[model samples]
Target: MLSVYVDLALGLTVSFLLLSLLVSGLNEAVVRLLSIRSKFLWAYLRDTMDGSDAQGRSWLPANPGEVFAALPFTRDPRPQHSDQPSPAQPGELPEREDKAEDAMVKLLYQRVQEIDHPKSGRTSIANIPPGRFAVALMELAASEPDGVEGFLGKLRSMGSPLYGHLKGVWETAQRDLDRFRQGVETWFDGEMQRLSMLYKRYVKWVVAVLGLLVTLVFTMDGLEYAKTLLRDNALRASVTAVAGAGPGAYEELKARCGGDDPVRCVTETLSQPALVTMVDHALVSVSFPAEGDPVVRWNGGAWWDRITTPSHWPGFLLTYVALLFGAPFWWDVLRRVTGLRSRR
Candidate 1:
């Protein structure tokens, strides 16, 4: 009975781990594909005009995208070199610009053509040096004919709004432009880092939510499935026998999942029909409401069925929490559980 219990529980656990791994990898890929963090920062920095102020006064410049475009902190596109290249035809014009593969890089390059490589004299800036963007903004602020106070006024006129805290900083560094610039850069760096962290947290949330939906769709609730094993003697005997052989199969499953590349790991592991059969066979053993269980209904059914079913909330809640443990964690858990069988 204990071995039977372990067999099904471990299978369900591995299934959730596999699904969670899928979710995590997709989250990482989608966040990069969408360039979520960079897009958020770009939108924040646009500083486009808002028509009415609290004082009901029309802010001077209605837009500031052009104002930002004139700044010198962005990177230019770099040319790619092919492994093998043929000489151009005698009259063939040399290629000019290669489109950037990264949207964020392309966006930055488009803005900084004039100042990308100030020393390079109108050539596109190959890359924005680290710490350059904030530094350039600070330099621009300090170089205004008036001090920080006056430069901020110009920004407000050009549609950039100021925070009270930033407005307050000018007084402390009133005597030293360099001090003011450093403070501004430090503040900007901190804010950008915060935004980056927030974006990462958002990606994690996406993975968790997606994992939840997947578990539900697949009916992978752990608690209910375990109960099925307990109630069905024939199914339990079959799974326990399968579980006896699971250690060898699990070793292979571990190797496939342990590969360096996540997509490759999932693809390779999923291709193993025997391993997949273990999970699918375990799922087949689950008892159902031949009567009217909402867990059986993918669509609208009864809210009461979900709430009243002893296994519903507990099973789903268990699976949901299991997903949060992540694939590596559960893979290790599976290893430990299998280790127990080996000891016997």
Candidate 2:
């Protein structure tokens, strides 16, 4: 019994440790994968900016005057054409072109601002050309700064080389991001498979454990009956007489003792095989108390002296009933820990 208890304890401990390790490993893998994905996304965005066409050009400034001053229009102004109809006035025409250009400029300026001081508002700037937006962005990239600083300072420091480096980093990060995404997909797939396997394994273990427990319970019950026999002199005498009999004589004696109370009559008449076999079968049917039942006690005396009444059947039934009821809860916990029910 002591050896059986040790074996059961060891098995449970090992199972618990294995379950813990599997769950922890799955969690760590997922967290690390997410972290890598976040970094990859950041790198991809930076690279996209580097590859843009506005690297070394000025688009718009927080102050409109600064943008107008930065433009090359002042260096080489177009001659006046008196014959052509004057460009429509802002109030007369809707200024759609200017507004569009302003929006683009603002967008570019905001990008630069984000690269510099991340907290800057993403307001759109105006007065940018449509066809040259990409090129202007590449040129403006040079204005961004090298190291971390405020928004404008960062914009002023970015150069062509820096843009190229950022582009390279972006490409690398994109590849890594793709690979990481694939890895996560693969990992989740594998996790589902592993969780299924573990659940099946645990179910199998539960069935085996429960079966063993039932068998042990029944066997202990039989042992209890044997102990009872030791106290019942008539039953013990009947068993002893049966142990000393031959099969033919026992059959004749059983036939002669047959009656309404055949088992009792056999014990009174044959006091042998017929009586002992009946007693053994009766003993086998008796139920054992559950583990935590109050009836189970250590008397600190002879081992066989410990005896219990049949009143604790309810406790035994309740214990197994509770275990059966807890199956759903265990299943839910396993699903949550393994992310089995989560959508990708």
Candidate 3:
């Protein structure tokens, strides 16, 4: 009986975790689809490339999109303006000779070639050096008459977190061009690391908040489920039997929920999974409390009466906290619990 109880608890907990993970993964998918993180990075990169210190001058394109569109790092560069004639019909004419979508190549061939090196009095973007991205951008920033000071002023305008940290380093190394260049590169690297950390932290908070909302909707009262099992012998047996074999039902779970990746998961990518399916399965295998059992019919008037009752709030709270532990953590617990069953 005790083993059965343990199995029931472990099985249900694992299910809850899996469902929670599905929710969390979908939430992340929404964020990625909206390109929120990319937009932030794009802003950071924009400030770096297009920033100007001169009264009205900049060596690079002003728009972040345009800058990325003109870069080799990007896959689809923007098309450049051309004087070539256009084909009138579909499949009626041969391919156009001008491939203006090579914005980056045109940039390198034209703009980079137009700028003269302050020291060598020569023009070249590729010949500057083959190294880090930040180093290359800094060299471009220096292509203008104002030089390194132009880049420094741009960083200062943003009031970036690193700006304060780099104050002393900048002051000490400003005289040596090599050291100043290194310091700027270090600053860029630090900003990216900080952004990465903040982005991770943001995702965690999203999970917690989304978990709370999902638990409420599912009416997953952990206490109610526990109480239902403890006091009813028939219900306990049914749930225990199902749960003992729950590990074997993993393929069914996957088939229902689809693949692990949220993108390929069942149903809509961002829409919440039919959590009512989870609730129904649990109730069928476990049954509700005797007084509240759906089979017996009661004055409560609705099926959710079993969950929406104020008495179940505490259990709901527990479930909410459990959800925050995430799928990975619960998966580990489920593995250990099932391993013990196999051993016995």
Q: What is the TM-score of each candidate against the true structure?
A: 0.47, 0.18, 0.49
> Model 3 scores what on Cα lDDT?
0.49
lDDT of 1 at 214: 57
Please provide, for model 3 over 216-285, each residue's C-alpha lDDT reduced to its tens digit, 9 standing for 90 to 100: 6556777766654443433334334546676544444444444463224422322322233346423232
RMSD (Å) of each candidate, 1 decimal: 15.8, 24.6, 16.5
lDDT of 1 at 289: 35
Q: Across residues 209-301, which tens digit of lDDT does each residue of candidate 1 receive?
A: 777765655555567566654434333343345467766654554454453553455443334433333234232233333366524222224
TM-score of 1: 0.47
Error of 2 at 275 (Å): 19
Q: Worst 10-residue stretch by lDDT in candidate 2?
A: 88-97
Q: Identify the leading candidate in terms of lDDT.
A: 3
TM-score of the candidate numbered 3? 0.49
| lDDT digits (tens) for residues 1-344 of candidate 2 | 35434433333233233333434454346434333222222222233332223243322122333322332232111111122222222111112222221222233343333222111121121122222333333343333343112222333233222334334433544635334334434433454455445434433443444533432232223333333333344434444566797775455545545523446664444444322322232213322334544333332332122213354344334333433433344455556544568457
Candidate with more favorable, higher TM-score: 2 or 3 = 3
TM-score of 2: 0.18
